[model samples]
Target chain A: MVNLTLIIALPLLMAFTMPIFKMLNSKLPKFIALLTTAFNLIVLSSNFTEIMAAPLILELGGWQAPFAINLYVGPLALVAAFLINGSAFILSIYNLSQDYQFDDKFYLLFLMITAGASGMVMTGDLFNLFVFIEITSIAAYSLTTFAGGSSYEASFKYLIIGGVGSVFLLLGIGFTYSAVGSLNLAEIAASAGLINPLLLQITALLFLIGIGIEAELFPLNFWVPDIYTEAPTAVSGIMSGAVSAAGIYALARIFFTLFPAQQFFNYLLVIGVITLIMGELIAYQQENIKRMLAYSSLAQMGLIVTVISLGTEAAVKAGLFQLINHSILKVLLFISAGVLISAAGSKKIKDLAGLGTKKPTAAFGFTIAAMGILGVPFLNGFISKFMIISSSLNADQFLITFLILAAALIEIAYYLKVVQKLYFEDLEIEVKNTAVITVPVILLTLLIIGLGVYPQLIAEPLEKAAAEILNNSRYIMTVLGGI
Target chain B: MLNFLEEWSFFGGSILLIFIGLYGVLSRKNMIKILISLGLMDTGVNLLLVALGYVEAANAPIINSVNPSNAAAFVDPIPQALVLTSIVIGTAVLALGLALVMKIYDKYSTLNISEIRGLKW
Candidate 1:
């Protein structure tokens, strides 16, 4: 089998290749991108078990161990890769033949964004992670602004705040490197307990702040609603679904691997609770459909963070299961929201009145998504939430269980607002939009429904993933060799 | 004496500069000025990287005639290498941010963030 390094590097290769292919004709770019991503998705999925079980490390250029920049794939990496590549494939198909033209350059940047994201999920080195993050950041910045006008304004705001975050991240990387004398994540984890406490403390705080913005955590997440509402829907899908997961994964990885700390979890718990309360409360106030989903996404991530910080088998697995479900449900919600908005000719929630009558199938997909998010029975969100509540309850966290169930109600309220507008409100203008469910969006909707019905399809793999994360020494031993 | 004082002054000045950047981002009206202050904060980070890696009476990391084992006395090269990458990435971000500021300016006509509070909650 080809090394897993190819999984992270293919998009970079295609980024360069797309420009060259443009010399022949612009038509070649989209297929080439599809081919590269398809190949990556297949490769990543096929090796899913090997990476999950064995602490697989793929060294770049045949260099060995901590000396080489390595791609370390454990269960977390595999699950992230699965979500990223799988969703990218679906989103690409959905975006194709939409109003926007997929020029050679656009496809090239798109593939590069995918590659950079996958690389972040796979790599085990701090320096390389920074490089890949920049690749993704630049691609995201330019991609969002491709619509021009206010998109540029929103993108600028993202860039300024994002730049500040980047500086903090780089500063953290420098401090950590100076302390550990190596860039390898496994090595850092091995040496973490012994590093200078002051330096490690500084580095950890810096990274927490830096990556928090990208993850859309509170106190630094002021940019999300604006950026989400402003970006094109496909970009919005990628931002909320794939990129947010990447940022959270980075935060989780560094906290778990680079610097394991009880204090960090304490911080995560407090911040996550605040974000959950604020996000749902704010989502309740939004008029725009996309903006509301953005707030909902923030709240869901807040819940994930809360459970992830618990650092238990059940809690971690519940978090992962929810993460997977959230991504699937979100894309379904976002794409259908886009379709509904397009049909109704305005993005304002009130303007979409009677859209249910106009596009019944799309309306039905959105309804299922709403139900899934609300943790209704038999759906995937319910299983994950049940796991979270059961695990928390078992752990004697009665307060957590109470808040989680309360948050579920808030989720229901906000989602029902949109549902009511679509089904109950009057449609002054009959949207002539046909019930044309595009192939990729349809597939994505089905995946959401399917996963909700049978969460074991994802939870089993996530459990394996969660087990790997807790077994930190396996990662430490694999890359640094019994240190 | 004055030259030595000037040299040592950069130490406190760098810290002050970072504080200033923070203050600007926290309190400024003009978005562009806030972005400039962000660049200054990056300067502080880069400076910190450089200062930590500096060795008092040392040569550069490159060596040919010198004994290899004695290289410990030289400035730590890794942080410098790391910071060089940071500086380039910072420049790229600055350029991108400036482009965005120009766009924001073109649309809103006013650079004051308070004036462009149209998207706020």
Candidate 2:
């Protein structure tokens, strides 16, 4: 009977109190962030079995569901929270080796972003979701500026886009509240059938646009390359690995649970496909390693969105699996890429040529992550990619299947280009003293290989999560029955 | 007709404000103006949220002796509460955006976003 709220509260409490800790000792914030993320993981794991058995609904302020803001941690949310906190935990370790100007503020924002995302995944109220989204976006907006050169420009662009997106989100929430007379998601889902059809469509469209921006879908993701390219490596890693996961979770919850309309799913399907193809095509052209990885991550988000939008249990399961894989692989890629970029003294792929011998740990980390993403066998990405294809084929989506494979081909082309350069090409520049990230790289590699070898290790959780997402009525019933 | 005007005016005005802000964001090159427009959009959304809870001839949500026992007479309070929270968040974002704009100005020596071509697709 561990209180689940502490997963969010502890990080936020620690984040806000970070400056005080810094005043006490300048070195305390990083350890505080590390401790908070670790504690969050422990809290989440303690509640995992119970939540999987039955979605844990915690009503706040002694009020019942439909009357108060509650937190519903179903298997889907639990898995997403795990990914968010797990990425944060790993990145906090990554942070220990790196120093930044105003390191205290950095960890503070980092911890807040982690807390905000965890809140986004766990909350059962729409307004609470909006608040969490704002918190995460604000922290992200500040976090991006840490790189200090063109990062200001990137942060501004992201701010404008994110600001507009939040307006739409608020409008959507307003519409939903006006129609349903309740902000609690479970209550709204229970009564959503009664909303006027046209209004429902409008609300759904508003939410799609709003959440779509955060999820980095097609036509609304121009800010992705810049922010990911300009932000510091750990910031970029968390943005890709944790924040975007939460964004997709919110989108899925909105579309699948709140408004299960086929038309919306069709829209998501089309958007996802376009995002996938466009991202890979653009990623293929980037000489900057971080920007290429950024586009590739964008494409992965699109792939996950398309699969989940298929609105089948198997499709959702495959999507979630791919999501898990993407988070793990992308964090490793960013971390190693961070190391490689520093060692090569440039962001250009050419400058990083033949550093494999000098920076073997980083190069190996990057190569394995890339190979995993390219769907080489006996890697985590291979399992997810196989599952995605099989599920899409079972659903008889030939065009989608074809497009996905085509994207994978482009992915392989660019990734192999990097790998070939890493091991085969001559060194173009003298290597700098790069931080040794042996521990995080080894840990992530083990997870990737271990998952690939025995996919069943996470099969139960993935299946249950997919089931939880697909069955929104059960969500409504569970939350409402808690009253 | 008056009732319709009252209702549609709030929705129409807010939507119009949002469109104006969006146009400013897309059309203006000056960064400060764009942030102002963003503020306007946020204000518009907040207004719309508050309007959503409006009830004709309704009292405030407070339970004073004058209007006590008329629970239904008060406008829906949730949207107002939400708007309060949103207003605070909007201000924070605006403040953050302004700070970023200041830093950008310091770096590029210009406020025009088009001139600051450090990043492009």
Candidate 3:
């Protein structure tokens, strides 16, 4: 059995040692960071069968159960960790081709984000989860400003918003500890029924709003666009792909395991629908490509949240599938946007006209991603979207079904507009070479199509992940070991 | 009334500080003041966490042979550990925020958030 702790620890070790490597060789840090993430990806993938068989519980310091911090390696957590490390690895490869003045610091923060994200999904202790969240946010905040200029403003906005979110999370944690006299998620969950109903509700709300900020839910995601637009493109890719996936995982973990209530799922349904509509509508009006993509990503997150809120086994399975699809699609979109923006030297839709013909590889990759996100047939996104809609219908949620379709129509409208501009619009300016980023873009595109063609490749794992999420008793048992 | 105030004072004060911080973040125009307010909120949260673990005349949770039988007499130590970590993280965030504000001032030549409109809806 692979030590589950290494998944979180390896990246942290690599991140902290990056400075020393930088001192040895100026170009060494990026290479080390890349190798570290690649190693972690391999390690994570190798343990798939083991994790799928049974959840691996790693208690820290050799202590037992609620007395010690533990890392829970269930299928749900494994899927999230895979997404985080997988995207980080790809982004690291993309980073290798780019030139930055502070490459060392960039890699340091990058690796820290990966480690923190991995830790966030795996840790079973509430305070430990908070610590990991802080680690991730701190790294993210610094990374937002890595490009300087307007990024400082973007980072500051993220700080203010994320800082406030952390406060809410801490307050919620305090309240939970006070009520349950325990910090372990399983123990708290087991004893949750004994807590005051009103206090429980308040704590649930506090956690929802707190984690909602990171998950990019509507009303809490105002900082998303600015950060995505202003931060470096690679940072945007990781933020949207890896960080947001972890956020959603954290949200799902909390709701499903800690506070599984019918009313809360109803609230999630309402919030998800609103977020979907709001993100899609606003995404339609965005002139800048990054902002458009950011808003669209938000809309996709809304869809996942909505489906997960359904609380049906098939719905949760579909939601996890969509979450995976969104992460892959966002990585492709943001990285392609990064390449396109760099090629055109502008982020405006009109400014990037006809680069599709100029840079056929990137344009092709972006088209595949756009189609996948638009739920085009023979793409991964189509399958997940179909599953979610069908499951909603099966559950007799006709209103939700209609709203989701309406939101998809809005999604189609905006993404199609960008597609038209990419291929049909006349060239207004010369485009730069996109040779460096084309590899990852093409790889992700192929993955999208391959998955779409045969989603059975991931169906078993996603089903297990969904079951892991819905099986609250199993989770409690894994952590508390029959109390 | 006195008993209620004494019992709930710490919790109430933390909530009050959090609200004040939120107000400052929303109402204050200056960037530095906003950061300071964020610091206030962090401090308040830390205080509340420590207060939650407080027991009426409890000793510090250092258990040695002399105090082996007095484990129950000591206060809960988990919240204190959490607060320690939280305080460090809060400081890091505060420093990062202040650094960003410094850079914002350099780029825009203004501290007013409303004026730093490089990005918007």
Candidate 4:
């Protein structure tokens, strides 16, 4: 019996004791981060089969579900945890090669963010979710300032927005507690039908405004591009790939389980579509490569949210698949682009011209990931894209389908522009010795192609997770009934 | 009237504090003031949470020699626990924000947030 609590606890324990490790050996924190994430992945996989068979609910302090905090590792949560830990693991590998000024603090924050994100996914309590969200956000705010210049401003912007959003989230929690007299997610879901309509509406809106900021929904995502652009590459990779996945999981849990209402789904649909179009359009105009990728990441987030908001099992599965693909592909893109940026000593897309020959591995990484995102055949993204299209069509949402396709076209144009600059254009700047990130690149690439070729590899878990997310009664019964 | 004061006053005052903090957050130009406003907002939310768990004529949720067995007379303790956690989280965030604001001050040599447009939002 692998205790799932270790997934969060080990990282947090390591993170706080990181300075002690640093005191003992100057070279210990990065490897510690890597080992922690690797162990987390191992722990998650060890419990995978059992959790797939039945969701594991761990009651803290020997108290029952309604009265105590619990960790619910449903199929959906298990998949999300895998994605979160998987990203942290890959980024830890990337971090091993790079050094920061206060690297011990960096690794500390890094581990905490991973722990916080995993906690967000597995937690069965709403207040616990808020705590995890705050943990992730605080770590992120500190992590962004590592770049040391404009990064402070970026971090400040993110801090202000995140602070306000958290306040709203607390208000929502208060409303939920006042109404339901409980904070357990399953308990709330079971009696959620009894919440007064007006208070429900207000609480839902407060939650939307709160979680939407973290989930990168439209209008609430203004702080995203700057933070992604200014933060170190590994930080950007984890934030885009891991933390946002947790955000979406929280959103899905709230809207689907705690308050499954047609009205909220409609609100999400509109917000997701708007976020998608806005992200793509803004990405089209970015001059900086990281900022471009940031906007593209935002668009991908919007795309995932839209697909899942369709409320069909197939659509949810497709959304989750796209989410998995986006995490893998974006991490690859950011790492490769980070290399390219350092090699060129500039962030402009034009300056990166003709690096294809100078930096073959990184160029190849960027190209393959870009192509994967653009939905080229035989890549993981292609299957998810196909699923999204077909699922939306099945839902008979023609206008949404058109908007999504249009966003894809915009995505293809910008990504191809960067790729063309990499290979086809003349060399505009001399290259420097870039970090050797070949290992992570190669690993992510293989996974992308492997999943692309064998789409059925994750078919069962994705289907089960989709069904688990859609059925609130199953969640309520599993958590409360198990008591 | 006393019942109204007990119920509406706590709720209304905290909500008003939240709005006032929000207004300060939006209307203030200085970065420190903005952070202070954020603190106010956090306090307001904390207050509101405590108020939500408030029960009329109830005591603090403590077990003493005299009130050892009476659980129903006690106000809810969950929100108070939540408020404590929230306060800690809020303090950490505020401190981090203030540290960043100091760094921004060092770089831009000004306290005005509008002037620190190194990266345009």
Candidate 2: stretches off by over 4 Å: B119-121
Query: Could you give candidate 3's per-residue lDDT for residues A1-483 as a string of tens digits?
Result: 467788778878877888898899999998988898888888888889998899888889899967789888899999899899889888988888987788888998999999999999999989898888888888999998877767887888889989999999999999999998999999998998899989999999999888998899878998998889888878999999999999999999999998898998999889988989999999999999999998988888888999999999999999999999988988888888888888998899888788888877777878888899889999999999999999999999999999999999988898888889988888778777653776787678778999999999988789899998998988998888855
* Cα error of candidate 4 at position A449, Å: 0.4
Query: Candidate 4 chain B — worst ten consecutive residues by lDDT sum?
Result: B112-121
DockQ of 2: 0.82
* Candidate with more favorable, higher TM-score: 3 or 4: 4
For model 2, how does the per-residue alpha-carbon lDDT over A203-290 read when each residue is reduced to its tens digit? Answer: 9989988888879988889999999999999999999999999999999998888888788899999999999999999999999999
What is the descending TM-score order? 4, 2, 3, 1
Q: Score the docking of each candidate (DockQ).
A: 0.60, 0.82, 0.75, 0.80
- The candidate scoring highest on DockQ is 2
Assess every candidate by TM-score: 0.94, 0.98, 0.97, 0.99
Better of 1 and 4 by TM-score: 4
Flag the better candidate by DockQ, 1 or 4. Answer: 4
lDDT (Cα, 0-100) at A181 in candidate 4: 91
Q: Compared to the true structure, candidate 4 yields what TM-score?
A: 0.99
Candidate 2 clash pair list: none
Candidate 4 regions off by >4 Å?
B118-121
